[model samples]
Target: MNRKLLVLPAVMGLAAPVLAGCGDSNAGSGGGDSIVIGTTDHIAVSKELPSPVDPATSYDGGTYTFFNNTFQMLLGYERSATIPSPDAAKSCEFSDTKSETYRCTLRDGLTFSNGHALTSEDVKFSIDRVIKIKSDYGPVSLLSNIQSVEAPDDKTVVFHLKASDATFPYKLATPAAAIVDSEVYPADKPLDGLQMVGSGPYKLDSWDGDKAVLSANPNYKGLVGKLNNSKVEVRFFETAADMEKALADGGIDMVNRTFTSDQIAGIQQGKEPNIKLTEASSPSVRYMFFNVDDPTVKDKAVREAIARLVDRDALTRDVTHRTATPLFGAVPTGIVGHSNAYFNTYGQPSRDKAAGALSAAGISTPVKLTFSYPTDRPATPNKEEAVALQKQLNGSGLFDVTLKGMPWKKFLPGAVKGQWAMYDLSWLPDFPDPDTYIAPFFAEGFLNLNYPGGDIKNSLLPSTRQTADRGQTDKDFLQMQDILARDLPVIPLYQDKQYVTTRDNITGAEWLLNSSSTAQFWELGRGVAG
Candidate 1:
């Protein structure tokens, strides 16, 4: 659900609305202090979103954060853990050795927000709607293995797959496979607007276009675990400055994203007495992709040449101020199947090497191409990242590059249609696995490079997905990473480090993000109650 860019009003610079009708002003330690989180990460990368709340079409991280708390699934990722734990289901497993029939049993006495039964039928309806709609902005690809679904009983749901896939549970653990209320959500269409009705940990109390208020759902009977703060609010800020100011002014209890380098440095140096910072090696990765269908980049040598000239270390150090680290492959470090394939093959940036590769392929010097990036992600440094990228490639004197920035609405669709010759995009895994890093970009190309992934998709990907033991498939992933490096369809720029800064008194800040870097607002607490 990433490439979680930015939403319309949020991207268009909507001001963060203050909390309404709240009695507590204490943002620090104390019982009943309502936890408020501030961030500039309210980005959604959807095309047909009349409202960016539908689980089917809303495939961005910001929306996924919202979905995780409101809509329950059969399985969910444990905090900082990859293995799926039971959520709505009391038990879930493949019924046959073929790994084709996935079955789950709902917990007893489950019900929706309106007291309607939360049955296997609702689960079947929700998943079927996603498949039938097949929105370009949705996670339809993740569930492509499903041949059909059945509600054998009110409490039991069965999924029949087109092929044997042991990783089915991992895919289902994500919010993409969210279970919605059949009575509320339309069968053939997405539920329009931000109206949420599901059985999860939190209920959407109110959304004033900027801040969304969430309260503990009394009807929720899932695996969301214990709630630290019973009530929480997610406040979207227009800029990093606004977010930091809100945190400093006690308007919010924590800051999730877009903090300036100076602010981060100051906090790390212990300059802020009231602040506490928690960080982790992040799974989020950003890279440059080439549309192989584009005539300018059709040649493999041309693609490989650009990869050689990219200065990743400088991009991370100067632009992001080393908040991020240079990445050599699609899968980041700490993940199971990570490899330094690009670094192994191309080494560091070299103008001579790039030029030599191009000349050897009989491609003329001073190749002309357009480098595209998104302008809609105002909260992020898209422009700076793009300008720096252009300098790396064009300043080589072997290429003449023109820089272009389009809003995400126009940019994403064009990218999916294979319109851009070269563009920069960011990614966070739909699930914490190597296939997430490789397959989405390769199989028909999520960046829609219009390149049939050839061996990677046809051979390697299917082979890797055949087993549940993710560690055993490292060899296949290693080869896939090698092929990506050899072909040079995309170049990995950097992987970010997750940072969540909260008031010193706030507890459980480290558990704010799960294994996939999805936000878990339920983890934060202020003080123990009587």
Candidate 2:
């Protein structure tokens, strides 16, 4: 994907807006021998899955991992108690300068669920296709440094970098680097109608647009082996409430995305025998965007004033019901280069500072700011967040806030064209890298959804990307954060914690912090009886 690659939906996080009218079910049940996962979105298998599945794009891991089980990098994370092991690639070694090159060797005898041999050609095909299609689906920017990919044999793959980058391997470990079957895929075409063919443990059984039927690949020979279940069916719902209803009605067995604080607590609070809610820190951050094209919001002072007047703690605690952490910076927690620039710079939510900033910028008149958020969409808490922001800003007496709402299917286009005065947006990291967070906001960034052109790109972005070393890059990244905090190109609000409700019978459902944050299906089967 070029600059627009991954740019279209970078702001839409994994949390769908299904919780608005969802209610608790007094009863929950499951199929005798199957694990059915429920969600509000469906797979777009039109083209090849982006190697990292473009974390900036909608959740594609449900399909990406079903094809390419092996990853380019694998390492253990200690954040969760399960201490889950990534079943993809075994290990990775970086260059001495963290910028030279990386050499990855696939596990010998690895076969796709279809029994196709997974070789270097397949890897090349996966990455090359993204650059070929030139859409937002691939992580070409992270792969731009690759002078060439030389795969001399089936087991060994070598990446020649144009410049040194220590984090490049991590990018490979992401969903964007998932290897697809080159023989099954054609070159120079959109991946819309192609039949699913991948080396992952699950093979595509059927896709009827709104639903996908997957069968366990008997050929899968890995540490986890084939899935215990015979088939998995995914159904998308327009709302979370309906999904929950379907779960109770035996339409689905699991809910895989974000849930409201009340819903999550109700599950935990009730201790329903068949229900379980697991919480973990996610790499997603919810923030507001200011369209630079809007003349009234174009001023840095107005943006800063808006940021100052809003209380992040209250928003997170009251609005999110403590399901999220008050965030002071755009970079989500658990990543490098995350800083508390918002808290440090603004000190606290203060009407006085907001008024002072506006007054200093020669704005005596109360600025009438129109806030835009998704309306009646069942995938995000956009409506709740927007209402809280409008209330706080309006109550500050420094501005007149009007809330405007639209559905996500339309809101996305409007925000892209810079049609909103102030918009609320959320970001789920495409890759677990600072670049994923920083690059998207830069005017030149392929995922710069806000499109805040000005010194943001000329001064802030160039300075940060110039530093090649990780340590120096850290400094550059902090400097960029400083700029974002001071100008409030978009006010960073809070980082969300992902919570999933499952039955006690489920086990090994670990969340990968990579591009997908997906659960390894094979590793999860029938758990030991309680």
Candidate 3:
């Protein structure tokens, strides 16, 4: 299929809003039986399970796993596809040329897990509630262009938009746009705890401590039809070491996320006979954000000098074990409109060039800066990467760096408040769009926290969002990348490659790595252990 079919066109010069899985089967005793999967604690679930499991309220990986299985959306992404096909809706398309009106026809006789009748009213209610509630961490921003939703009939649903947005249909495929039964969930507030009533492939059976038990929903009638396994238990671990040990000990059938570089190296070395590992291209990225409010980073020369002096190739080779791709811009490759703007502007690392940049800004040598990163995050070697950055900069004899490490819980508050002069963080794209990369970081006082003044906040972002044509939008994205490279508000470090490990008996494990960078638990099944 043409990937360009996923790209939506703009109306009124507004290109539209850009925001920003499966498994297998069987043999043997474990074959076609319940499969237990283990994951790191990075999958964010509330202490109180099932109730807060409300799709409108949760936005983390763990919650998404539940939403992906339990709730059905109007549309969903097919494995590895940029465009969205139908899930709950039989068909969906824009009804008007301005892209201001969208219509979807729900599948007939659809019902929730509880046997509640599913209709267009449920679809309208789900989206309207999300916009009305507008939770701080929730994905309300994804639907900011939504004007209203009308359930014209039991099967037909119409959406009115404030502006022409080609990306609107894609938003329906996200976790935030999950359909809910109005009878079970309050329209005003999020469903408290794990009290969920969904109409997807799986239903929450029970939760025991760190594990969630799920069973295939008989009432589920969606695009992803049938299940290889009727039951699945997801186990959460505090660290990759523990998860890896469990996989080795046969305590779990599969493991995903939070694997250290050394752990991956061990897996690749064929140290574990029963375990099989695979890697997929991921859109995840790590970068350093400068608090422009700080006196040291306020100077453009200091930021540029730091960017030039740091060696990305060495960092990826030594620190990440080539597990991550060296990134040159905010928008990673694979996505449309991606550009190596930083590489084109900064070129290769050279101390002389860095020195010249600093000298040109009338700054003396031996500049001192404090870098902070979370020590507790096992997902990436932030601390080790920080050490490498310090060594590289200090080795230049032009910088004196002091590194500070804190747990993520404590570090996040300080980082968001702009308390740190410079800090490191990673972004997993909320949506697969160039706008997701540009808007969040450059929009003044957003995730970048520090204000990125000038064209980025004013003309560039507005113009980029307004251009509806993919070609024009791509051009705007290139301009945005160039602006990011020139401004140096944040330095792109690397893009992560997703690694997942499963037992030899597990079939279809490779297909579970969907385009959204989440696992499709439904696709996993057991076979005779080889």
lDDT of each: 0.78, 0.58, 0.74
Give the per-residue lDDT digits (tens) of candidate 1, residues 272-334.
779887766677888888888789999988998988998889998877788789999877777
Candidate number with the higher lDDT (1 or 3): 1
In model 3, the number of clashes is 26
- Comparing candidate 1 with candidate 2, which one achieves the higher TM-score? 1
Q: Rank by lDDT, descending?
A: 1, 3, 2
Query: lDDT tens digits, residues 260-311, model 3?
Result: 8888889999988899887767777888889887987899899999889878
Order of models, best TM-score first:
1, 3, 2
Ten contiguous residues with the weakest lDDT in model 1: 4-13
Top-TM-score candidate index: 1
Over 4 Å off, model 2: 1-32, 44-98, 153-155, 221-230, 249-251, 271-273, 413-421, 449-477, 510-516, 528-530
For residue 29, model 3's alpha carbon misses the true position, in angstroms, by 17
CA error at residue 389 for candidate 1, angstroms: 1.3
Could you tell me how far off, in angstroms, the CA of residue 317 lies in candidate 1 after the best superposition?
A: 0.8
